[model samples]
Target: MSEEEFRESGGRNTVFIGRQKPVMSYVLTTLTCLNNSPDVILKARGAAISLAVDVAQITIHRFAPGLRVADIKLGTEQLQSEEGGTRNVSSIEIRLTYPPEGQGEAAKA
Candidate 1:
């Protein structure tokens, strides 16, 4: 699939997390592919540490048992505002890395 298609499909995988899950959709804004792997950087809307965890759990179930907390790196930062006044909002960035493309051969190396 094209990158856009892949991203869209990947986004669908997280739909369950947002549906009926309070503050989940608000917490996660976008999911960007990183380093050409399943590694994704989840851009958050506000300080949503728990929301991020919820997302990771959904991803693990969708992907496989190989998913681990260590593989999913988490971070946060404030967004830049146009005006002088700084907003109270914070963003959580999560880095989720899955296994490489090739499995059998790569495993030996």
Candidate 2:
């Protein structure tokens, strides 16, 4: 799917956190929730998994306490290394869901 389409798809939104600062991911998650999105998925691989977790925590605890973790999926993917060897990298997907009626002031939107 196109990037734009992938972003504005119903109650679901996905944020891929990589080298960017954790604040960036936190802002995106908060905005997604404020925009009436019921679900937000945070994705990261390898070393970035901790960053993804921090984003999820900040979003749920600081920004949107009413939101809750709906699911978590973890796995490893095989990828080709630059040295022409195969490597397995761990990945994590964190799904957060807000209430159907929304949370606090966001409910009006």
Candidate 1 TM-score versus the reference: 0.41
> Per-residue lDDT for 93 in model 1?
45
Model 1 lDDT tens row, 1-109: 2224323644522322233456434334323232234555553434445676677666555544554443433334344457865545443445555666565335768
Query: What would the TM-score be for candidate 2 when compared with the true structure?
Result: 0.73
Best TM-score goes to which candidate? Answer: 2
- lDDT per residue as tens, model 2, 64-102: 788778899898877778899988878788888876664
Q: Give the number of colliding residue pairs in candidate 1.
A: 0
Q: How much is the lDDT of residue 23 in candidate 2? A: 66
Clashes per model (N, Cα, C within 3 A): 0, 0
* Per-residue lDDT value at 49 in model 1: 56
Clashes, model 2: 0
